[model samples]
Target: MNMVNTQVRLAARPVGLPGDGDWTVTEERLPALETGQVLVRTLYVSIDPAMRGWMRGTPSYLPPLGLGDVMRAWTIGMVEDSRNTLFAEGEIVTGMLGVQRYAVTDGRGVTKIDPAEGPVSAHLGVLGVPGLSAYIGMLDIGRPREGETVVVSAAAGAVGNVAGQLARIHGCRVIGVVGGQEKCRHVVEDLGFDAAVDRRTEDVAEALRRHAPQGVDVYFDNVGGEVLDAAVRSLARGGRVVLCGAVSQYNSENGVGGLPGYISLLINRARMEGFLVFDHADRYPEARARLREWVKEGSLKVVEDVVPGRVVDFPRLLLRQFDGGNTGKLLLRVED
Candidate 1:
């Protein structure tokens, strides 16, 4: 097939938040699929805080995006053409398809999506990496027990919201730490969180104390830095801290901020562990089944912030995640 694919490529490594100069948008005709490869027309590209980390040249869990490489991203799209036996034309799939209007893959990490489970965009949010991260971080790592106090930083976000709600489902008191009043209200009233701390207006440590007077038994942290320190200071005896992500420090020109409250972990006999969602890929089927069930029964709500734009809009759209401009999962809908 003959087609021109629009793509966003890394033009330069960014100092802080990436700007237009850091990227170059171009269009190129796609080549014919090789044997064992599939052609995907990008539908929704996931915008995540980790994308910022991936932009740096520093060593990380994954390799940094090479200069001039297609901006790495997880995307959900339909298989428009396929030479791979594992994938079929018309099948919806999700994988690291990058920031392009079309992706050609060998089906290595791609997975088929069952639309009957929920809206396809949901696969990028509630049932995708965000949901899996929350599930493993909360259930497998934090291990919240009934009536325990669970606090989630960035609670209005994709992973944080689901983490807080999962704790609530397990009979824990869920307190969300979010940015603004509207987000605070959204978590508490709309997402069934027991309480919310407006990190912008309220003192986080003081708020956590007020909400979790018994102490935070489990703290699922998304935004590290001051918020992480506050959570550490408020940890209950034998508390568990799940270090999911550090959105707060992702854009820092200096290195990641100091954690002053880390000493409290030793004092409280608590443990803090960092996790990558890809590490738990073996259990995705199990996680997806449970998430799908909860979403179906209205026990877990799915929230997505999707901006429809072409591939060229990716750079600007991704900035939304860093500035707290979006609630829930942030996705760039690749316009056909």
Candidate 2:
């Protein structure tokens, strides 16, 4: 019997927010595995903000996903069949599995992970790039000091959630800026953030003043728009802003991100730095090991919002980030 693979491919570059028209889903027969290759059946797909950026014709850290190509995504899968020595049938693995039911690879970028270590979705999240992105970007760039206040935007989302929590673990007062009251509650009530500001309901600059009275020492900026402007205005002397991503601008036609007012940086003597997780690829092992230890010790928590469905749901699901639909690390459960 032949195996059929379902895939979501990029049909065109999106104008602003992607619509269903931008994607094409197709089913095809899977070919026989080659030597040193493994046939993986995807179980979970990571939905991320960066996907929007990758869809555009723009400069990026990685090459844009070409039209007619399978949409690139980080995923966890089960090795159903293998001709590779490093991978075996029935082993759980993580790799760039794309938005597909199955993938055959030469085992180049794949990593074998024990499902018993944690939820497989977590490997795409907290224990995965989301976690590493937070762990590396926050610590390496923000460098929060004890008793200092750290503010993060998109605080209920993946990177922002972990970054804020990790800052709290470093003994800093952590404040989150989210879109609505519900997410605000999740950040403070459940995630232990010191306080949360609802961007849609509250005046962000005033909220910053109230929550970070002494001024913010570190800002882990995930959204780059008006929220960034407010954060810069609230920065204390020598404050540091680590630019993890500009999710808010990924779909913009013009370079209009409501870029932060500059005088504040000079007057406050503050500094802003941008980083990409790909650059720190060398330290991934270290970050992974430490994150695993913290997770096992229960000092860290991972919240994953899984959308149960097949690969065809990916296009609409990607909009959840912009619509404030998902509460935690958003994931697509491709299979049982």
Candidate 3:
């Protein structure tokens, strides 16, 4: 099989928001598939706030993307050819396929996706990494008890939207903190959260007081920084604060900002825990099965913001996640 490979490569390390010159576009020919390998035609590429960290040459949980390498991304595509017995040709799959028109992998991380069960884009959102993050962050770390209050920042994002809704499912009163009023409305009406605070226009602490009233039991934080500070001030006794992602600090040109004092945690008798979704790999199937069941029963809502263009638009779409331009799981459409 022959196909053109238009790939997005890292040109320079971005200091803050990535510019046009930060990436270089290149083209290559598709390579042949080997035993246990499958050739995939790129369909959609996910844009996550984590990508900003990946571009920097720093020590993180994972190695940073080296200069001139194909920018890493989560992609959903169709198998054009397969030498792997586990996946047949023409099957839809999703994984870290990078930014290119085509990908060839040994099927190590790539998994099959079925649109019949739900929209294919959902495998990248509600049923994918973001969804898993929400499930584990809320239940495993936040541990919202019944009649408790669960507050989430980036409340309309891929992870936060699901996290807030899942908290409600477990009988916790859910309060969402979003960047704008429109997003606040969407979180309350569309996602069915108990209350939605517009962090951009309203004072978060005041809003939290009006919404939660009794103080927050679990803070499922996505956009950290000041939101963390507000949650701390309003946390109830034995409250749990889940540190998921901090879009606010992701692009801080100097460094990650400092949070409020640890003494606050002691005074409140509250605990704050950091979580990476991959840490729950062993339990992904368990989480996915339950989330899938919810989707089938119309209990869970899946939202996706798709930007259409070629592979070159990957960098632009990646920046949107940090800019609050996306409402749900953000993806770049690589093919028509």
User: How accurate locally is residue 200 in candidate 3, as Cα lDDT from 0 to 100?
Assistant: 82
lDDT of 3 by residue, 140-226 (tens): 998888899999999999999999989988898899999888898899999899898888888988888888777889999888788
Candidate that beats the other on lDDT, 2 or 3, i.e. the better one: 2
What lDDT, from 0 to 1, does candidate 1 have?
0.93
Off by over 4 Å in 1: none
Report the Cα lDDT for residue 275, model 2. 92
Candidate 3 matches the true fold with a TM-score of 0.96
Residue 241's lDDT within candidate 2 is: 91
TM-score of each: 0.98, 0.97, 0.96
- Evaluated at residue 50, the lDDT of candidate 3 is 87
| Candidate 3: stretches off by over 4 Å | none
Clashes of each: 0, 0, 0
Give Cα-based local distance difference scores for all models: 0.93, 0.89, 0.88
* Local error of candidate 3 at residue 4 (angstroms): 1.2
**How much RMSD separates candidate 3 from the native structure?**
1.4
Q: Which pairs clash in the backbone of model 2?
A: none
Highest-scoring model, lDDT: 1
Error of 1 at 282 (Å): 2.5
Q: What is the lDDT of residue 124 in candidate 3?
A: 85
Writing each residue's lDDT as its tens digit, candidate 1 over 1-336 gives: 789999899999998899989999889999988999999999999999989989998779888789999999999999999999999999999999999999999999899988876689998898888999999999999999999999999999999999999999999999999999999999999999999999999999999889988899999999999999999999999999999999999999988999988998899999999989888888888998999899889989888898998888888888889899899999989887
